[model samples]
Structures are given as structure tokens and as C-alpha cells.
Target: MSSIGGFLAAGLIGAYKYRTRGTMSTSVFLMQLRVAAQGTVVGCLTIGLAYSMAKEYLFDKAPKENAKSLTN
Candidate 1:
């Protein structure tokens, strides 16, 4: 999913940039795309990590209704 999203993002960036300035060559375009894709993937991982940490933190702060076991 991340890979697909990255590729899509890269493709969009390539099209947009190419149409705007027309200065970037094929190799530069390819590199830009690869960087864009990598950046997207890294961004996703960072977001996921932050989300997990926030959830864990919230859960830790939450109060327990009862500590006793059901059999008790």
C-alpha cells in the first residue's frame, strides 16, 4: 500500500514539475521520483510510530475500572 501510494505520489510530482518548468532531465526526474517515493514511505512510518506511541501513552494514562479478577 505504501509502495503504491509512493509511486502514485511520485508520478503526480513528476507530471506537475515537468509541466511547470521543463528543466529536469530524465535522470533527474527519475531521481526526484525515487526520492519522493522514499520520502512518502518514511513519512508513513513516522506517522505510524507517532500514532502507536500516542495510543500507548493514552492507554497507560487511562484508569482501570476494577482490578479484581472475575473469579473473586
Candidate 2:
């Protein structure tokens, strides 16, 4: 969910930049999309990593019972 949001935000920002730059060439469009995707992936991964670390160290201390949790 957050990854999708990051992609959307990146794409919107790229679109805004592209429009402001006034470059409508195919190459420029593709470049902008590539940059957005790369940025989104990196950002999503970083956030996921940080969240996982925080969950591991700063919050939960009990062993997970996946089966029990799934029935909830």
C-alpha cells in the first residue's frame, strides 16, 4: 500500500516537473518515468527496512504466532 503511494507521489512529481520543464519529447518522458520508478523503489525499500527494524527492536518482543493471528 505504501509502495503504491510512493509510486503515485513520484509519478505525480515527475509529471509536474516535466510539465514545468516544457520538454515533451519521448526520451524525456521515458527518462522521467525511469527516474520516478527508481526513486519509488528505493524509497519504498528504505521505509520497509526501517519499519521492520523498528518492529524488531522498538516494539514487539514476543514470538509471532502466525496461525493464531490469522484466525483473529
Clashing residue pairs in all predictions, respectively, total 0, 0
Tens digits of per-residue lDDT, candidate 2, 1-72, equal 966776688778877877777647868787868976888678878998999999998899887776464454
* Backbone collision tally, model 1: 0
Stretches off by above 4 angstroms in model 1 are 1-10, 19-21, 59-72
Cand. 2 TM to true fold: 0.54
The pairs that clash in candidate 2 are none
Error of 2 at 66 (Å): 15
lDDT of 1: 0.78
Expressed as tens digits, the lDDT of each residue in 1-72 for candidate 1 is 967876787678778877775776878877876787688778989999999998888667877778877794
